[model samples]
Target: MQKVDAVPKTNKSYTVLISLIVALGGFLLGFDSAVISGAVKGITVYFEMTDSMLGFAVGCVIFGAMAGNLLAGPLADLFGRKKILIIVAAFFTISATWSAMATGYTEFIIARIIGGIGIGGAILIAPIYIAEIAPPKLRGSLVSFNQLNIVIGISVAYFSNYFLVNLEGESWRWMLGVEAIPAAIYFLSLWVVPKSPRWLILKLNNVTSAQKTLSKIGGAEYAEVTISEIQRGIAKKEEKGKISDLFKNKYATIMIIALGIAFFQQITGINAIFYYAPTIFEQAGGSTDSSFLQAIVVGLTNLVFTLVAIWLIDKLGRKPLLLIGTSFMTIALLMAAMAFNNATYNFNDDTLNKISDTEIKIALADLNGSSFDSQAALFSEIEPKLNQEQFLDFKRNQITNFIQINATLVLMAILLYVASFAISLGPVMWALISEIFPSRIKGIAISVVGFFNSLVSFSVTQVFPWELSNLGPTMTFAIYALLSFCAILFVYKFVIETKGRTLEEVEELLTRK
Candidate 1:
């Protein structure tokens, strides 16, 4: 390897600026994800959705993301990273506008899926571009800029939802539409950032242009060394990696670690918590206003703890963080399950009075003063009294008023869970994925695992509404808690420490028999 310290210090500030601008895509991805939580109730009412339809509406974004994950790398390879990013920004802008304006369920879903495509592309490409341009010392931090932006976007979406929740007549439209402002900004901003220098060298064999872009990022000497390395890496791979290559015997360990981390990351219910935070709080007997407010707290807690994770990840190492995070995640989920388990529902006069719907109020009048130990039991008692629509309305809209439980404990448990996730699986999983794959198989391996990750995310989000409706919150949380425990054991046995090692060193360590 060649050293390039002879020139003046590299233009680190310029490099940081480029990374931040590229990372703005992450902001849109996060905003698109969480903003829908506030819209869930409104859309359900407007669309007249059943449990399954509601789940599809909310989880459809990940469906589109699956397609994006498969296509983005190939598309970027054909054109350039910058162009695909511009296209992603365009998708976000269109999705936000179309979704807000959509009057039909099909139209609204189509719009949301468009944004999901942007999410799939942005989440994968932004970090790749940042890593390609950043100096080795700054690479990890610069790539992390995307993850940090994601949490910031999540917090901002929560605040945006709260402020718009009180708007009259379809405030959900405002919540979903406001994302266009940032999307447009990101679209225009892409024009300023250069194409990936490595792409220029590898695809076009335009060393001069690659060096020019790299020179602006660092300096002439830095560009020279970087170009040589990129070319050498490309030369060593006589054939590009294919999807079939990932199944080979030597890559078995890599596949196991990558796919396992990807599976556990979503199956443990982080997205379920984030995408449905307001709804979860509402289930614990909170008012709509309080639920939205508490969701903002969840987002803020996630943001703070994510910062903590970044600071401690290299210091604590990857496997330890996964072990610690998954363990605490299991405990926090159990705490939530226990809290919901201890809850009892009583429909007193005061609770009945809180029901605004006249039919629902009258229907539940007979059940006043009757108490039930579990949601399933209470729902069963009420199931025969009302018709299908009435029962659905009672369950979705009116049940919150009749619950008597420790709201504080549920809130605390959720906050702890979010904190634990942010510090461990949230960032650590992506970091480890990037480290474990050999450079030859890195692109395809990431795509395969990323697609699987989206598939799991879609399943969790899709089933959550149905779970809440059928199995009740306690059982739903218990299932997640069980999965979290499994995640801990998987990490302890299979995951290796990647801290302070070069990518080559980490690859060699993991690949060795």
Candidate 2:
């Protein structure tokens, strides 16, 4: 396996610039995926929905993502990566604007699904584009730029939602609409970046065009060497790529790693935390404003640690990071479970004394010292006792003051969970997915695993409200903790190290029985 040394200084800036342009797609992906965290309560209230309906509306984007991931590979293979990425940006813009103006739940779900399509496409294509074009010495860090932009986007969405959380009843609309600005920038930025040199060489069979694009990526010497390597790789896999090729014995190990990474990444409930951060905090006895503020903290922690992952990915290797991150994730999730498990809610003089707000005290005046097993139980028992407005007022303040669990402990646990995910699985998973397959089948292989990824994400996000309603926070997080435990073992025993290896070398090494 050859290492990518520093390219000629002249092409360094050019390589980084193009990589950043493509990475904007990741920004929109993060913003669209997470902006909903702050909007879910508003959407549920505005639409008068059941928990199931709320979950469906929240998870609808995954359906679109499923469709987009299913098609992105073939489409990028046929039409070129850059063109499809441009179209994905357009979809994001349309989804954002339409979602903001949506009049009903149905319309909002449709808009979210549209945005999901853009997210799915961008998630697959951006990393592929970066991996194909980046110098190997910097490939891990450069490709990680997509993940970095994603965390930045998530952080910005959290900030935006928090800033707009107090905008009366219209705050959710503002959160959804702000995505359009970045989407348009991503669409326009495509004009400046060159096409994937490998895509041009193999798919287009236009070496002259490929060489020109590669030249812009590095220098003429870098272009020649890269072209030779790509040509040799293509020659070895002369038989054309098909969906079936991925199932062959030689490709089995890579397939397992790809699909396993995709599954563990989502099934461990990362999206559950990201998509429902505010709701989780609110359920754990916090005000809506406080929930949104805590979500901002989660976003910032994600941003900072993702940068740490980028700094360490090439230096430390992929398998070690996955093992380390998942281990910490297990510990963090157990901490969250314990925090929720020990929490007790009792409406009493002691609880009353904790309340400093007048409206809350007045609303709960007759019910001091009454104990309920969960917030859901508490709400159900009290709903018929007061008017709707009074019920809501009491509930908000009750949540703010009732829980015996330490709020800071819950917040720290969640922050730890996000940090664990950011530095290991978050960026490393995508880097491995992009690097493991043969060039010819890379698109289709990633598509299959990516589709599976979206499906799991959809299922988890869709069922979360129900999980909270039925299992309670302690059990919901307990299940996630168990899954994280499994993921750590899976990484330790089966996942291989792909840190410094080239794509061709990884493919060759993994293909051996």
Candidate 3:
């Protein structure tokens, strides 16, 4: 192994092309996560789901992702990253097709869970692959391509939902099944990209193949240097990392940072917003069409700001972005909380006419021209007037007609919150996780933290609808606001800057802390 005086110039176009193809998995993951938002109304009606049931249907994908997170790393290590990614693509294709055609509740859930498995694998594996292949100079930006594709997928899903919303019967089916075309394309695209060079060297001891792949990414000299580094890193490790190794005292800081970022990322309500964007807007008195449009705006904001993050991540460093992003996220959430807090539900004659259910319309006639200060107050006055089914229907569908809110303010707040997240937690967490771990424990540690991240995402998505119904939007947004504030403090106290540092340099720096 020879020591190199300078970092080799990489074959930039080649590295980027491979990264873009692999990151397509992130696009699929994003699409699968968000397409369901458009389908929510249809599925709730089609399945005749209660609040809890609706939550389960929406959150089940995360449940499947948990299984994927657990399985993806070990399988990638045993088989190879490229092969597992192909399997992930197949899972997405199957899940999309099956979920679209599913007529029964149980069947729909099964289909979604299968897709969730793909989501789990794609979300973890794509960045890991990108990180492994990328030069340190380009690592942050290239790895962020996964996050960029995610936001693009999300934006596309919103547009797809809006376009397909009027498709005769079972419009949700079209919205969901449309994903199959892209998923199949992704499956085929995986065939062209090379396996992770690190995986080739580490798992199969195929130095020649690894060098060939690396040579394509950089040059022969770059390949030689990188291979030497990988070999040296491997030589220093006595054994492969076990699950127990993550709990060691020396790794405590890494574990804390990983777990905290994982926890805050989801717990701050990003997924809940992504999964239920239209619903949140609708709660603020938006019409269905307007809500969908606003959701698209949210997606676009996310996409644009994610691009900004990519540009700044390697420039401004991770901690500053987290600090700045979390501060704005807190403020935006507070804006939303205040907007919802000041909202009033008023049932006038015009508002009553919007209720399609005649029985419920007549039942609510007595409350005509009356206004309530809050959703809880409004629900109290209306609950005893109707039976359980009617009440649920009114809450889900009709309440939007009567609410008087600052719709523009709510929209602005949501967009700001999303933009803040896009620049900060959304891409940075995965980037940090990929960079900070020791090579020995990296795979298992990521899986553990990813599983935790998915678990938090599931809980937030699962309980969101219930919170809107029970705690009301004001309290729900306020809770997120508080969490966002706490996130800022955590980053300030714990997270270290990792800008422009090699993975080995980052590990050494953090290990000393």
Candidate 4:
């Protein structure tokens, strides 16, 4: 298990400090992932790409994250957790510099993918490290530090992106390059924290070193009990972890729980909102500035609600939070769909008057008197009237002129959806994955489940741009709404409450069946 056993109240400060340092990795994960939201428009314009290509560019990092997830577990198990985190920090630094300096589309994709590797490694290892080091009494809160940092990072990214949006052609570069500062800090900070005591004891059989580390974590008595527990736990293990060992019938129940939670988290379209927040706002009749401002609000809402989740997670238990959050998510998504469902775009006299830009006004001369039932229809009507250059500019600014809907309702729905997600699946998935699996196969099990999680994230992010153009907002969000409803049922029926339980106890309870 990643977390230490029960410790005295006095020494718990050390545990919190180390957990905070490792959790910085999650901050980088959030910053790197969401910074792309602001850059989407600029990158598309700079790369001169089509909808499918834009989707590929946006989602490519998740593909790299998938690879990183596959490798992080075994590597962390083999090498030490601290060393792997240092390596991940280096990856983040290099990826930031390389991506900012990229001159071509291919180079940009490669750089983002590299950063994604760091994101994946950091995402899994930090939580595992926190779990390993934290005492059982504080395990839930400490492990959630990773998620807290993630949302904090996302909030910072949104604020950064919002402020940097005025930089015109170079804003995306600045937004991405800022990550190097935190990456360097995280890298240098790793030296101060000790390696995982569990790793030293179980993998290296260095009980002396483990004892010292555990003593630092808790106290002498606490260390003695924890070490004894570790020894007893290891004695029951049949062998070292194998890939096939994860699927043995004894482990199947826990495996299903891990895989299901991972799958459900991404399929609910959370990343689509995160990766494309500004774009979503723009599609709902917001200006570039308002979109960026609204993105900041979303970020703040996420940050605030994540704190709420951290406070309540151990108190309410995992299954209750899942049930509550998914229920809210379902309602919020339907609210989003309903908001978009009533939208209509038309080139009436009022809309025509709103087009102050001379070039855009001239471009829309032929369609001045036309009315469109939807944004898609308006876009289709305008598509044939302009050249590629004019088409790009037109697409960017069209919603400002003709959209007729309650834009505030859409924003509120999205914020509600984000708030619900932040308090539940956003942080809970990582916590649950770290908790549910048996220690023997924990590393590989997390890697496999994380791989599938990134895979789904990749698909959702990559297709979101296309989905916006083809399926439209109403249909796209309606699908997510339905899925959210199903997720509530899945959690209520299949998921077990795991708060306040030790990793060993949870493993035994779940797998005994």
Q: After superposition, how far is residue 83 of candidate 4 from its true place, in Å?
A: 0.8
lDDT of each: 0.87, 0.87, 0.93, 0.87
Per-prediction backbone clash count: 0, 3, 0, 4
Off by over 4 Å in 1: 1-10, 218-221
* Residue 89 Cα positional deviation in candidate 3, in Å, after optimal superposition: 0.3
Candidate 2, 272-306: lDDT as tens digits: 99899998898788877889899999999999999
Model 4, 67-128: lDDT tens digits are 89999999999998999999999999999999888889999999989998998899889999
Score every model by TM-score.
0.95, 0.93, 0.98, 0.95
Give the per-residue Cα lDDT of candidate 3 at 188.
Answer: 98
Query: Over 4 Å off in model 2, which ranges?
Result: 1-4, 349-367, 372-401
Position 139, candidate 3: lDDT: 91
